[model samples]
Target: MQLVFEVCEVADGNPVSTVRKVFDGVGGVIGRGSGCDWVIHDPSRLLSSHHGLVGCREGRYFLTDISSNGIGMAGSCERLRKGQARLIEDGDVFELGALSIRARLMEPVQPFGEQPVITGVPIPDDAFLALDPLQALDLEHQRQSTSDELEALSAGVGEPGAWADRHAADREQVAMPRRVEPANELPRVDSGALASPSDDVFWMEFAAALGLDLGKLDHVARKALAIKVARLFRLEVERLQHNRAYEEQVRLISTLHSDYPG
Candidate 1:
């Protein structure tokens, strides 16, 4: 069994419509800082760099307040003082700064054939864009565990600013002037473009509507189609992190998968 935390919307604390992201391991710090286990990108800046720590004790989970602003229960007006700790149960919702998050214990399952595994080695910039999207899909699925994904991104991306450069370059080519706020709404993409959908269901539907047999496509053709899909997924994740779309990010990550026809 693993302890999972579902982060609700940043705009308003509510349950996520999709499966809640499940982070592996016992528990760790929750904050806006990159170093924290749970990195929350809060645009309002209400969350501290090192907000609080979620730790396991006596076979139960506990949240400790370590931030300057403090943490609180979902409906309570009171917040925990720095250094204070509270016992939390599965399905308990709490407030960390402005973000509302729910916690629950879940039995681990391999949604894909085997557990989703992300490679630790960094892919060069030239290769990052060219790498197969199906492989990228596998890595993205493995990202449901917050620590595993962040660690891979932080370490596997080689240098500090390389990831940003790659992202900026991709955006320069396809990004629009204004931003869209809807969680499920996809950005404006060329109709002729390949890999338009973020959800796997949409991918399947998209492939089916076009009467494309993904399994039969040549390697080069499949790679061409999947590259854009990979780019879309990566860009969407970056957008969510930057906008502090916590709920959307969680849903996107937890549900990301490409069920390629066998």
Candidate 2:
């Protein structure tokens, strides 16, 4: 599948032409010329000192910042630090310097129980053909007229009356205060005050109860078991605290009673 990208300049708002320029430049670097099937660019060099990589790999596209400056991912568990390759997902927001790029993941539609087929269409030679001479002349005239109007407006501002008005406007704009929303507060945890058993101790007791040989299991499997046991214990404690009867509790109690034979 062809990797899709949406690019924009850091200083300007989303302009289609500017985005197209960056995409086209980067596409030439990796897509058409390089043997590599992916296109990745460090956009930081263009607008800011920050550096990042944007590319696709094995049907997945990602934008990661690995510069001295950092990139922030909105609502993410962790801020992507330098040299960190964060897996991009649909609607993922990446902030690099003053610019933000939002990833819009597009999945190819496949027939039920079927793999998606990639299509390659050849470009037509006529696509690059120039416009008629008269049409080109008219377009040039329009552009010159627009430029002249802009120059006239810029020249008019040099007048005393215009200069004074412009200065006052600039001052007023600077004097206006911007309103900002308060940051969302996180829950405060006092680690010193909380009494919680370590996972190692709990896992040892749980493994003893289950009669499992810890030495026989791999480290990954043991960690998985510890997590599962911890979750199960937490669920049982919550149920008992709420005075709820759970079948697992009854089964455990019956098993213990049978072992004791009392």
Which model scores highest in TM-score?
A: 1
**Residue-by-residue lDDT tens digits, candidate 1, 44-70:** 778887677665543455677867677
Worst 10 residues of 1 by lDDT: 12-21
The candidate that wins on lDDT is: 1
Global CA lDDT computed for model 1:
0.63
Which residue pairs overlap in candidate 2's backbone? none
| CA lDDT of each prediction against the hidden true structure | 0.63, 0.49
Backbone collision count in every prediction?
0, 0
- TM agreement with the true structure for every prediction: 0.38, 0.28
State the TM-score for model 1: 0.38
For model 2, the stretches where C-alpha displacement exceeds 4 angstroms are 1-3, 7-17, 20-50, 75-78, 108-262
